[model samples]
Target chain A: MRMTDRPSNEEGALAPWFAAGREAAPLPSGEFMARMEALALESQPAPRAAPAAPARQSRGPGRLLARLRAMGGWPALAGLTAACAMGLWIGAAAPEAAVDWVATATQEQGLSGLDPASGFDYAMLGL
Target chain B: MPYDAMTDTSDEQLLAAYAAGAPGAARALTARLGPLAFGHAFRMLRDRAEAEDVAQEALLRLWRAAPGWREGEAKVSTWLYKVVSNLCIDRMRRRRGGFAALEDVAEPADPAPSAAARLQERSRAEALEGALAALPDRQKQAVVLRHLEGLTNPEIAAIMDIGVRAVESLTARGRKALEGLLAPRRADLGYEDD
Candidate 1:
């Protein structure tokens, strides 16, 4: 209370008794405190279980294997086999120019066959 | 939390920590709030056993509410006081139409050395308690919360779920009643010298 907000005479008269009441405010018995403590602990919600460690994700070599498995194991292998057979067929029966280009790709890796000067050469021959 | 730090922690934080299973949080909260609930219940009911039961019940509700407690919505102390005030009201209603005898009031929770030394103060406290017991429950509660408990009128209004003016009125009327009740004993209680 501030000096300006002084208590009325009745309030002042009653103040000491209130102070006594405050001083005499009951103390919870040890047994009561223990029971409350037990209740508090018992009622406590378990600390939200730490978010379950993110499910271990398969990585490294297992990643590709997992993807292949996801794509349906034997069907994915069959697709690769079919693609390889197509490449073998191209190798066995393709034109000589295609074979030469393939040779160029594997050997010098040069692409002069794709150069614009070759277009001019074709124009000169009118073919 | 260290023992010292828990004293500084707000009730909501302590409750949140308790809900989250922080060690020592339970005891710390109990230490902070137990006496308050018990004291208010004791003063209102003036029966040690019933007051204890009411205090336990009030704190039990608090424990149950811990998990869902939201800060900034309501104060923990105010909530507990409100619960206690209501619980006391319910208890008093169960025994309505009968007034308590002066001897039925319980003794001081802890008899302080100073209080025991000053017999006059103890008599005055007893006299006031007896006078308070005679007031209507609402008036008694208002007066107790306002004067004995030293709470603000608005806080008492919230606890009692009444308007501030109503609190002021009840307290004023209650004190007047108490003065009337205690007037005869004033000379005997040593007010003449003051």
Candidate 2:
């Protein structure tokens, strides 16, 4: 932006060489631009859908690896396979599986005991 | 809104709009800039196919960067010049002896008379490319950016990440060397034949 910032060489000297190049040879057509536009259009990422809060899937050994593969293919598959296998093996050796806590807790709490008409604790005996 | 009217819009503006879901903005941006970028690649690399490949890669990068683009810093062309220049330099470095050979100098024969002339023109272009390749890396870039690509000194300095005075010195050195190297074929280049 400052004159001091510019090149010390005079522009008039360059004008002749550039003028000769342009006059003797002007650049060709605009085809290259068209091609670049096509490439840009093709490469643009698609718009993302609104976040619906993805339903949580219970984590499993291969889950992360599979998702990674879906994004990056073979490179990811090679890097993730051993880790995923180890995770799966560890999971298979676990003594107990994770519980359906929501359903189990609801049933165990016996809040289902209040019958509207009878006012009875129907779930008191774990029936 | 019409895209031509969008010409005044900066690349950062268009990229942001494109990321925001305006496909037209992307189209306009590329259409406006493609040739200049491609021409730079072509002249710098001296290979149409390679230039096209570089142009495609650079454009793809533009799209990929659109979403997180921050504006008001670098001009898009300046960024692009840096990207493409680095790519060309990388390619040149990868191929052993790919740079210009000063010893390979040959006089360019007149092209327009016969098959010999055409061959001469091709060889001349190759020789010029080689002489250019022989220059120091910084000089070659300075020459390509300033002369062949028609960028101004300050703009070239920005792209090369150097100061303007450095750009001038580099270009002067580059031109002196090129003229000396090509001095034998000045006639072939339409300069006064030595």
Candidate 3:
């Protein structure tokens, strides 16, 4: 067959050559396939289960809020709010007292106003 | 599907089954895609050992990508062809001292009944392989995929990441070059007539 001729499935100049090539085409040996299968199995990600039907989540923020309300209601909310308010008030009103308490604690621990270098040295001793 | 049922399933479905961790999908894929990958690599590399490595590595990548594989994006074989092609190219680039001369590459032993005919066949195959090796990388790849692997121009284009026209041109040029290379040995290769 001429070079310009398209290669066809039927017998032609190139057909024998292609046939030989195909016959000579190297197949993976059984050992090679086994190794590849092992590698594939090893590399394969563990299958994720079908997600457990999404756990039947509460539909919306409204529903979630409603559930929370049903569990605790306004009394619980009021108590939590009061406790937060009390904590904030103490923080704002007793800043100096808080600072003094921190200072006292540090002094008792022998770390009062220590410079970073001294702190590092002290930390080096596993304190 | 049952393991027996998977035998007749498409490659895409097999890959999906593999991704889903079906019990038999790994074996199914191995039995299916492993030979294609090996043949392609062996044709490209002309070295059985390296080809085996390339095939295993290609399959390993497939396994790693199975979980994230997007079905219907491309045929599993096409995806594998692309991967094997690129891997072979990478290996060729990293080969020390350049491409091995044809004489240095070993040919597999043939088992034909007649020694003379077997030798001639072996020599013909080796000559073709040598000619193929001498081709520029793209032309060689195009020719191998187009002719030896029996893939369509479009499929080859997809694997080589080129347009169909480009694939056609490359294959044509490759065949012409092969014709020139092998013409002088026509009689020896038992192609005496034309």
Candidate 4:
């Protein structure tokens, strides 16, 4: 800011004219002030919360979402869902041969047979 | 802050308060700057209606800019000066009548005791305005901001987006041009009476 503090004697003889100009400087009318005040108030940015995140429901729609995209989207998700349901159904009602083999193979190892869904059978049988 | 209490606040603080939706902050801002902006525009554009539009537009922009307004980066008045000047220049460039529009300018009559002196003062002012209007846009802006508006060179530099030396040069040239234009009418405008 190594500049002069103010404009120098450039006005000189023109000083009187400049003085008149300043004296004659326009005064705004009441209508203008009111209009400006209203505009200022109207244009104020309201105190608002940060914008609502579009993913408000899901906290981290990040890596999992990217993984879903990589796995071929909703169709792949549907396929995966169907596979899970089938796996649960088959595990509950597996072939008795498989259960027998598990019992025989694990007897020496002192492990019991896998007997998932046996409770449901007992409840149905009333024994 | 309340409207009354904001009288002593800096323009930046007032603007921040307005941005935060503080009650009466907007009114405070308008009250503080409305006349400053309007006077500059009126002197630049001459027509009261056009001046009002430019002033309103600049203040409106200031309001919109309030939220992101960085303190210490620039003064609010400087920003308004820049905006108002540019808007007036734009209007001036679009219209083809030169300073013939001076006829449409509104001059408030002085309440001086001597009617003759008042008329003479008005004539001096009008002569000055006519000379000012004849100047190139940059020169007129520099001169007005310097002599008439009484802004410092640094403030004028910020407002004009130019360097201090450049502001100095423009005002110098403008003042010279004005002197030459108004020289012949010195006695006619009652400067001799002074």
For each candidate, give its TM-score against the true structure. 0.76, 0.59, 0.68, 0.69
Would you list the C-alpha lDDT of every candidate in the order shown?
Answer: 0.79, 0.66, 0.79, 0.83
For candidate 2, the docking band is incorrect
Q: What share of the true interface contacts does candidate 3 keep?
A: 0.57
Q: Which scores better on DockQ, 1 or 3?
A: 1
The parts of candidate 3 lying over 4 Å away from their true place are: A1-12, A50-127, B1-5, B96-110, B113-119
* Candidate 3 lDDT tens digits, B92-185: 7777455445455355465565686666666677777887887888898988887888788788889999898999899878877777777777
DockQ, cand. 4: 0.43
Per-residue alpha-carbon lDDT of candidate 1 for residues A11-116, written as tens digits (9 for 90 to 100): 8566666665665666778888788878877877777677778777668767877878998897888998999999888878886769677788656645554454
- Writing each residue's lDDT as its tens digit, candidate 2 over B68-158 gives 7777767878888888777777766666465556665544334455675455445556555666777877788888777656678888888
Q: Model 1: runs farther than 4 Å from truth?
A: A1-10, A58-95, A100-127, B100-116
Which of the predicted structures, 3 or 4, would earn the higher lDDT when compared with the native?
4
lDDT for position A44 in model 1: 76
Q: DockQ for all models, in order?
A: 0.39, 0.13, 0.25, 0.43
Cα displacement (Å) at residue A109, model 3: 97
- Number of clashing pairs, model 2? 2
- Candidate 4 or 3, higher TM-score: 4
- Residue A39, candidate 2: Cα error in Å is 3.0
Checking candidate 3 for backbone clashes, the offending pairs are: none
TM-score of predicted chain B versus true chain B for each candidate: 0.89, 0.78, 0.89, 0.89
Clashing pairs in 1: none
Model 4 residue B181 CA deviation (Å) reads 0.8
